[model samples]
Target: MADAPLKVDFISGAVDYRRRQGGGRGQALPKALGFRKGVTPDVVDATAGLGRDAFLLASLRARVTLIERNETMHRLLAEAMARAAAESPLHGEIIARMTLILGDAREILPSLKPETVLIDPMHPPRGKSALVKAEMRQLRDLVGSDPDCAELMRVALACTSKRVVLKWPRRAALLPGLPAPSHQIVGKSTRYDVFMKLPAPAGHS
Candidate 1:
């Protein structure tokens, strides 16, 4: 039989586990997005698949807007978030920090700008990602292959004033034709390529 259809449960399971595990500014995601004491920036999760990163940011006290382009996935995320919100005071508090938008990110991303934008571009699974493979397949099922990630990258770059973070497999090749990142934060299996807005040239403004 085909793998079981994905069921999103934000209240319990891995979501809850992560919520209770706790984190700090030194974590890869937070550090890449420039998190610091007393500086929890508003963030836009451009490819808000499953709301994992978005929720993680919210759990860290960032106001996060999650833009998911797929209708089914959006509905699933909406339901999961609603359930989580009603589950308990803690989950409700984090859910309150997240706002979900359904539509093509490239078309709507410019309007709902946030200080830091996060994109986890979808690519074919490369190696032994057994534990993560299910979610990867769910991503393929939910959004299919993302041919427009580069365009979304462009939109994110144009609209974000602070920074845009692209999450990629640590060893994977960077997307072609894009400018180099201002810096990168690499972990064991993942990396975040951070592109910050260029400062105005002298006398330009």
Candidate 2:
């Protein structure tokens, strides 16, 4: 039998993240995801850990699909979205734009026909000087490292039409087996590596 799911306050966490928008690291992510003033791309957050980043994107009015394969995490995310939709004033709208899927991205990405795929795989802890947040520490405890992240990237590249974005520590090594990013958005502690899809062959499209 499986253990009971862990509980988390994702609604409150998302609220706090929203309150911090337009300031510090918060401002960098949306731009990295290709968000513009009046355009909201459809996004698939392939590794929706606790749904924080996914919520951020939806709060900016982007339609987001959150995919989490862990049953415990999936339950927690579902509850958080439900509570936010019911309690948080803007979250109703936010949750409306967000969808949840309980499955692996490798098996799921092809069917979604994603325009953008966002990957933030679990990585090793940085040097002792860099403190991992409580939420992130808890996530690492639950999910361990994402060993197949390279495969996830490969699957995302094949399915996504516009671009695939990867969030990694600024100083961390790029995922093995992936090519260099076309461009990058660097922040103080993290960076978003973007890979744009090739245009379809004229005869094929």
Which numbered prediction scores highest in TM-score against the true structure? 1
- Over 4 Å off, model 2: 1-7, 13-15, 23-26
Per-residue lDDT of candidate 1, residues 1-205 (tens digit): 5777776777777867876786567789999998988899999898888888788889898999988888888998999999989988988999999999998888887888667899997864777666576766877867888887888888889888899999998998888778999999999989999999986689995
State, as a TM-score between 0 and 1, how close model 2 is to the true structure.
0.89
lDDT of each: 0.85, 0.83
Q: After superposition, how far is residue 48 of candidate 1 from its true place, in Å?
A: 0.6
**Candidate 2 backbone collisions, by pair:** none
Q: What residue pairs clash in candidate 1, if any at all? A: none
After superposing all C-alphas onto the true structure, candidate 1 shows an RMSD in angstroms of 1.8
Per residue, candidate 2 scores C-alpha lDDT tens digits across 74-123 of: 88989888987897677688899989999999999999999999999997
TM-score of each: 0.92, 0.89
Task: Please list the residue runs of candidate 1 whose C-alpha ends up more than 4 Å from where it truly belongs after superposition.
Answer: 127-132, 201-205
**For candidate 1, which ten residues in a row score worst on lDDT?**
124-133
